[model samples]
Target: MQEYSIAYAILAFIVLVLKNDIKDKFFFSLTFILITLAGLFSYEWKDNFTAWDIFSALGGSSTIALALLALLGYLDYIRQEEEVSIWLHVKDDKGNIIQKEDTNFSILRKNCTRQELQGILGVIADVPRYELASIKESEFMKDIDAIQIGKKKKIAIIVSQEKEAYQFNSIFNNKYKKIEKLKTQTSLRIDKDSLHDAKKILNEVGMNFSEEVNIFTKMIVTHKGLSFEVKIHNDEVNDLTDKLQNALKEVARQSKEENL
Candidate 1:
């Protein structure tokens, strides 16, 4: 029964990962293999009284361990890490102090997702997706919001997309959609249409909601203002926006949601 509990938990995880995006056929199949193997061992089988003793029977913690490893692998494949900075900055139009920029950005860093990148930039730049917690402990990244949690509890991180690299800096200052979110270099073919859907998905997924910096793009085939919306947690939001957009593209076009 204990094995069954763990196995079911793993299966649930597979379902959750798959729910993010089924477009990655490779990921889909990998998930299937993991769930199948986990179920096979956890479920009763004739002459397969393997139980939790899989480690001993397999001459080591190979089979069940492999199953767990497989689960981890799937998680690594689907789980997206977003880069955010817990920064200290100027306040609102009313001209009031925003906060310490230290404590304000600090708590948010600790609670929400955090990651490591090749480097940090005030604006757009290529950062290989490398998320890690230990990097948070570094003295160098002291001001960066390594974690974030709670209400009105917010974070401020620059999205590395060249188009909207100035998001954090321009949140209040930059005119909405004025800057061109360059299309060619954003590291992905992001569009305005899909980003809206991603916000709905994040809200549905229960992420703490916050504002986003706009990414400017080159004039599209329609010359439709050349820009896109990138919510907070630049990578995760953009990734979700892409997936949601792609999925919706496959979903037949729909009306635009103004506040993506």
Candidate 2:
């Protein structure tokens, strides 16, 4: 029994290390065969070996297999919890909570037209390595607009001007049809009063105007197969562009890492 336990432990280790290389069907078939063989070898062949003896041996083997599976599950759960603690709630030395959280920026000036906002965002979206896909009005909301960009790594630009403020958003994804493992979102809000000066700075930087009302920008990123949400806020159009580019780069990096 000791030898059998040692052998099972070794087998479990191999499974854990090469789980990606082993197919599910092959692993299950191998497990069934090994368990059956273990049961047969352990059974004592007395003068009249009966079906009950075989059943007892198989049941004992099954109990050990189930225990091993439970142990693996517990280990995986512990690993996940540790990762969440490390990655999900990161903070700076000042305890400022530097990790992913919704951020807000204040914009104080006169209101601008939606078209003008869209043009400014269009220039911001013009980052290196990413091509503009589409610039069109949103189908759902009249006041809201969108600009689609990128090919292999796609980003959906969401701009809204429903109330008196303006908003700029960028949603990053790997696929055109469906969003896969990695996604990152960034949103910027300009209050009603700030639009005039916001437009001026953005225009001096080369202004055009357009916007969303999401109070916080939600950026979702996957690290080591674990997904978490991050929020960021910035005051300038250049900062907004930098954030978008950074997000696109992050999504690209994660996709490459995961081979998605």
Candidates in order have lDDT scores of 0.42, 0.41
Off by over 4 Å in 2: 6-10, 23-33, 82-260
Tens-place lDDT digits, model 2, residues 1-260: 75366547555665666543555466555655565566557556688878897788777777666665566557544433331100012223354433332112111111223444344444433233222212353431232211110011112232221210012122112111111333243344445545554555544543244422223445555443466766654333456575444544554555457675
Tell me the alpha-carbon RMSD of every candidate: 26.4, 25.4
Residue-by-residue lDDT tens digits, candidate 1, 4-120 = 476567757766656434444655466556554555565444565555554343432235445655765565443333234454334333544443333222322233443333233
Against the true structure, what is each candidate's TM-score? 0.24, 0.29
Best by TM-score: 2
Error of 2 at 114 (Å): 31
Candidate 1: stretches off by over 4 Å: 6-61, 80-171, 174-260
